[model samples]
Target: MRRPFEQLPRSLSPLPGEDLHGFVLRLAHRLDLTPIVLLRHTGLIDPHRHSAPARRMFMLEKDELAAFCTTTGMSPQDAQALTFKPHVDSYPPVATALLGLRGLSPAPRGVFPVWLLTTSTRYCPSCLAGDGSAIQQRHGGPWKVVWRLAATFACPEHRSFLHTTCPACGLPAQRIRGRSRSLMVEPHTDPLHPSRCRNVTDPEQGPCGARLDSAHLTDNDNPSDDLLNLQHRLLRARPYGTSSALDSLAGHNRMTDLFVLAALIRATWPLTADLAPSPSLARALDHDIGRPGPAPSLRISATAQKRWDSDVFSARGTAALLAISARILNLPLPELRLELRRVIAAMPPLDDAAWGQTWLNLRRDSSPLFRHEVLQLLDQRFPRPLPTHVALPGFLLIRRRSYSPKAIPQFLPEEWAEIITAPLGHTSGRSPGKTAIRRGLAAHLIQAVTGMSLDDAGTYLGIPPAWMAAWGRFRPLEERLHGCRADLSVLFQRLTDHVADQRAVDYAARRKRFANWTLPESDLQRIVENYPGRRRLLARGSQRGARMRVGFSALVWSQLTGSEWRLAPDLQPLPVEGVAMVDAGVIHQLQGRNPDHQPFYTYLHDLLPDYASTVLEGEDHQ
Candidate 1:
């Protein structure tokens, strides 16, 4: 279907890591020709373009590539190895998302998949300098496809992080030089062609036409050998399998997948905010073996936001994430398991529906251990066949009566010190460390003073209340009761005073309303509309009918009053006994009649207004 190139004047041998575009540019420079002429001679022009070819040189079709290789004295295998096409085809997730097709979709020509890869190029100065050592290598540096990977922060050979932009001019490395006519003012038309350095402030004099390979590594920049080793291992290692069984998470787009999992873990851990080490492990994410790369910048992604996930990581951040993940993965299996369990256990309980929905996406994951750990957590929290019998209501009252003490036990100063200092053996892996023991002890003391049950208090204060119960057995009964009541009387007195003062206010408000008693228009409207049959009785101006006007419905008022108040033909009549003055007791009784309002009376003492004011203020304020 396609033919080879007609002929060529000259061609250079393909360099290692050289992409198709780089190879083409290098060949053209060798022949003293422009990239446009070289591409045209090889039949690589985009058919739809009006001026110069619009398509990038990297977006070469198979036929166009064959023609170019045939003319350049290069092999098809060499071309495939250097290009990004093969790498994109091999990664299924990238292909599916970027290409919008799966399984049988061949990559279409001239369609640049920017989503799958970054357009910004990065290069290693040391490697570039190595390429410049020989006179023949001056045209271009040996650029690797791996250099384009966002995760590949460090250069394996150089042991230093790759540079994306020029430190002097802030111009990004590998930027196309010949995009517009203005950019073409100096030496080239194709922006893909790198020109001399454009930075005027660069101390190195001359036209700034220095090769990118000649860039220098600063003396203070320390290189990481461990990161370099890891990078090489990642490049050489296969995804599906490795010698260590712990390495099974490796798969297609393994680096990206690993970074995603780490982010997911960070999101799911609830207490990570509080338990996070001072300054966060995230701050030091890029510090690989003492060498730090650029600071990580996490940007929110629209797609992830729709799914309610964290912001997407920048390329440098992704590299840091990968570095962090690599360190985590390198830990021994037991240690890793322990750390994971700690994280899961530290999360506060979530509701069934929410937890299930959050975990649903991760359920079908390929990694058995990861899936098992998460599922096992859910299983432990809400096991199958939930308990049917509800706990007894008024548990505190029941406990007080059942365990009424003739004498309660208390601890001595020495024993109290021991309880405060000693560990309460196996506190659900959530035990506070020695550094936080004082805070933890204070929480436990507060719990004990409040009379909280063992399990609830233990979980809250991170101290075993059950253990305290056992310790109390050895103390004297009188001492224990004394300790329990020592700080309670003042609190109880304040609470009683507060309730009495509130009741007095309620009474005063009621008396004022009674003094100005009149059936408001709103109350009349409600009664008339609700009981249309009683309208005639209301309009009759009967003495009994006027008293029927009350805040509550007839049913509730009648139920509260019983034999105290009578009903006329209107259904509810005003009280005859307390005609002149309003009764606050009647209002209270009316409010208490509703089932929803019943709970408010549980803590209040039943006292009349006159007596309540005397008890609250030492004597009546009026």
Candidate 2:
């Protein structure tokens, strides 16, 4: 028979904003018992680890906590709500694993959130160092769940930001007390006391037991109380409601969307700021920057790029970035919403590829919401109006939206005749096949304006030749293709505008992959001598001559060889399209197969058609 556990003589009342895991530890300490002993008594011990010597008091599961609460006469609801459950909606995966949500939910398999949290816990030092009187009265200040948020910079009560890494050892704050049998240190005996750095960096030496409190705070970059209040509200807010439908479509929940928004704001900033025209946002960013002098050129460092690209961010950085995004939305700094309607409204058409590149950078591995938001913004900016003069506007608009061209009312061959040819006063009695006229006009326009074949122009516009054939299917072709008949000036203006827009999109996609690459001095010299414009300096040092980037070099080579080279991968063993792994013996055998004994390049070309002409050093194919 299982022995029945009894309630404690003195059970600690739940403190305000206290996490249940910490509360349980405090309870165990007050009971003069080890966490394992307390858990065993409460019938919550893991059978697998029950007999195992000692273990850290990591987070507890829902069932275990419920059992603990039942045994200790504490309300299970209070225990759960006080723990990490409050933020589960924002960071579902961490909470799901922490709480073992699969055991709680009916259909838990596909319910993971798109974003993740930092792999460490954070806490406010000042909040932990309460007065002794307060400690004796109700234990101590609680570990507020608000501090767990990546966007939470400061503790309103402390007027200082939460600390994560220890100052002494630079190790992350240890939330789960290390020892199972006893408290790690004397100061930490009181659960609410500020954590001391107990990180053991050297086995021979004792822990760097420095107290983690605001008394030793060095930075003065605390956000104002108003900002902190706004952050508090934003962090606590959940993504439940009608707006979540948009989140569902975009494959992101509310919290992940906020992260994407912050990233986009940081990436675009001043350039996109002009589109929204928010004085409040400008003022907030300026205040945070605290630069009285003329704002220096905004050249982002490589370190900053890596930080921005990563999903994780310091609370201070996240808060500042979110503030700017809030300003762009024209919402009060305190007001928060999960939907992107206002944000999309503020976004200007992504006219430049750099803007598109910024969107791509922020939305990488992100939910569909980011891409949908961009497309919707473009649609709002340039609605595909019935082509008044030429198909160029229609094509550009359709291409920008990235929706099916068939969905829109396409221009007919007669419409093209009206725009391309001078106004014929009398209607012609004879009309040719609609498809033929449409194809001829499309071919003529593409060749004349872009100076490329029909196929190449289609590729540039992200449309297939087969897809273009279906365009204007309802109309008939009557006349042979000829030179454009529209006003010369109008044609030139339309062509330039269309081409410029297309180029911006293309450039942005290309630049997104471009990076600073280092090459050997010999390769650098060859590139500079052969293609001066292609060489770009990335870094330079005394011992090593200036290292040049190979992004443009790779792009030039791709164009020359008619074979694509992917620039996204590491430069060391670069990623190519058609290269295959072959043994040295295979190469020897293949070389021997040539009856006339042709060069190795010839045999390699026979194996991979595009490889022989470009990769090998020989007569240029072009």
User: Considering every candidate listed, which one attains the maximal TM-score?
Assistant: 1
TM-score of each: 0.44, 0.42
Cα RMSD for candidates in order: 25.3, 23.2
The whole-model lDDT of each prediction reads 0.39, 0.41
- The window of 10 residues in a row where model 1 has the poorest summed lDDT is 392-401
Say which candidate scores most in lDDT: 2
Candidate 2, number of clashes: 12
lDDT of 1 by residue, 1-622 (tens): 3444676766677667765555655666667776666666766654332223323323445776677577766677766665555554333223323333111233433333222233345677666554554534466566566665445566766666676666556655543332221111122333232323433333355234445665667632333555556566555433223555333223433433343344444445332333222233344332321232211111111122212112122333334444545655555767656655665565535432222223322322224444455456546754542221211111111101112111111111122223323322213221224213332232323233343433443343323343344333212221222313121222222322332233122222222222233334465445345542333325545443344344232223222221111221122234444223333333444335435543323212132232223333542343
Error of 2 at 518 (Å): 78
Clashes of 1: 8
Q: How close is candidate 2 to the true structure, as a TM-score?
A: 0.42
